[model samples]
Target: MPIGRADVSPPHWRKSSYSNGSGGACIEVADNLPHTIPVRDSKNPTRTPLLFTPDAWASFVTAVAIGRLAD
Candidate 1:
């Protein structure tokens, strides 16, 4: 079941590992979707989520893991 924008009405969002318990900068990702990875700000879940292809999301995760996206 490929996920479309309209199909993401109720996503099961999970917080990023980088997120802290003190309500700091937090991002939530919904990978349960079939084809798309949905990302949203934990602080503002009602806002529209950003969608990414599974491959693109995997690449972004790899980059972040390898410090290629470090500040």
Candidate 2:
């Protein structure tokens, strides 16, 4: 379940709602991955994806949304 390598396959991909419409810098998430959540750079969809637990991903997303974690 280690999709951190240079060639990971995402079953699905979804861009963040906060992504710039013009496509500057954006991050995407691929869910429905059972116990894991796959994340990748939209700018490089063909590359490796960072995997995380569903809870962890949710926490991160919540934190980001609430401004608890700053970029």
Backbone atom clashes (below 3 Å) for every candidate:
0, 0
Per-residue C-alpha lDDT of model 1 across residues 1-71, encoded as one tens digit per residue: 43444454567889999889999889999988767799999999999999998899999999999999999
Off by over 4 Å in 2: 1-10
Deviation (Å) of 52 in candidate 1: 0.3
lDDT of 1 at 66: 97
lDDT of each: 0.87, 0.82
TM-score of 1: 0.83
Model 2 CA RMSD to the hidden true structure, in angstroms? 4.8
Residues 1-71 of candidate 2 have per-residue lDDT tens digits of 45654434546888989889998779898886677788889999889989898889989999988999877
In candidate 1 the C-alpha lDDT for residue 55 amounts to 94
Error of 2 at 2 (Å): 15
